[model samples]
Target: MGTKRLKKQWLLHAVGGLLMTGLGLSLFGEALIKKWENAPLWDWLLWGTLALLVFNAGVSLVGQAVVFRVKLDGRNEK
Candidate 1:
């Protein structure tokens, strides 16, 4: 992908990850404090989903950074 597209994609992923993480934390916290008997399963599911989103976001950002850095390094070497 082009640099701009890649950057946009990274931004989207990062934002989505942050939003999901926040929602998951809020839900999980509410469930814990409220002592809902049926919440345990849903809590675990939300956490797992949040973890995946954050992981994917982190990997995408890191990958883009490394690619950009390599490009810059190559340009400087020439």
Candidate 2:
């Protein structure tokens, strides 16, 4: 059913977002601990990429939550 498919998609997005957040945090922590002051361009690039990943994950999670909530509210109203 459509509801089942929606649930599956939401679950997938939630899981993917969590994974990306975890990975981004780990990378960020490692970079901080290693003191990236004198790190090469590649290291900075990696950090920037991780930061972007975290930001993107957060956005995706929030977007999914909003969509799910709207769908749930609509169903309840019907």
Which candidate should be chosen as best, given lDDT against the real structure?
Answer: 2
Q: lDDT tens string, model 1, 1-78?
A: 555665566566556556655665565565555445555776756655655665565556556656665665565578
Q: Which stretches of candidate 1 lie over 4 Å from their true place?
A: 1-39
| Cα lDDT computed for each candidate against the true fold | 0.59, 0.71
Lowest lDDT sum, 10 consecutive residues, model 2, at 1-10
lDDT of 2 at 21: 72
* lDDT of model 2, residue 5: 65
Error of 2 at 60 (Å): 1.7
Which pairs clash in model 1? none
